[model samples]
Target: MKRPKPTRRKRQNLCADKGYDYPDVRQLLRDWGYTAHIKSRGEEQSERKQIPGYRARRWVVERTHSWLNRFRRLLIRWEKKVEN
Candidate 1:
């Protein structure tokens, strides 16, 4: 099936978590002009101790996730469709 096109332009400077740390992911992000802010999961905690900005940014992302979860439909997975 054909995927829907994005409403916005292609992205740059993607701030993904460690889950997107693989070479393929990083390469793709780079190809799109995105400075992948993804660190290896094993290095994440250690890196935070060295870089205050990483800690701050990570927390903001986490807080945003928590906020998104506050929506009842998102938290409960109310939709029967896979998109939900």
Candidate 2:
């Protein structure tokens, strides 16, 4: 899919969390020429670990949720269509 796009436009890298850590997922990404940035989830992984930014970004969303909860409609998901 991405191979054809490189001829027309620039290809983009995909990001994922720990859920997509399986060997098959990583292999598919490699075969497609993508740089995997997924965090590993196993005891046998390297001792030196890279800190994930998702935890810090989650704090920002928590703060936003705290602020938004003040509105009853927004908290209840009153909108019929999500696109709205």
Candidate 3:
């Protein structure tokens, strides 16, 4: 299935974790005009480390994902209706 179109304002930034560092995901974010702040696995190394202002927000996203995973229906896409 194709992704839904975003109707929000422009220049919005998306903060995600290292798991989302794939090329296809980055390309899709670019196609939607979103500035991706996803951390790369390699960046965890001492030589590549750099402090980012949005680094504090990464934990929040990770926590939300973990919480969502607690529900079997949502985690496995068992729910069909959006309002369900």
TM-score (all chains, Cα) for each model: 0.40, 0.43, 0.42
lDDT of candidate 1 at residue 73, scale 0 to 100: 60
- Once fitted onto the true fold, the runs of candidate 3 whose alpha carbons sit more than 4 angstroms away are 1-9, 47-84
Q: Which segments of model 2 are wrong by more than 4 Å?
A: 1-13, 42-57, 73-84
Candidate 1 segments exceeding 4 Å error: 1-11, 47-84
Across 1-84, the per-residue lDDT of candidate 1 in tens digits comes to: 984433236544567877777999888767755667876777866866887665355788888888877885665766766776
For candidate 3, the per-residue lDDT at 16 reads 97
Give the Cα RMSD of candidate 3: 12.6
Model 3 — which ten-residue stretch has the worst lDDT? 46-55
Q: Write the per-residue lDDT of candidate 2 for residues 1-84, one digit (tens) a residue.
A: 554432224444768988898899988877766767887776324433454432335788988887777685674676755877
Better of 1 and 2 by TM-score: 2
User: lDDT for each of the candidates?
Assistant: 0.70, 0.67, 0.75
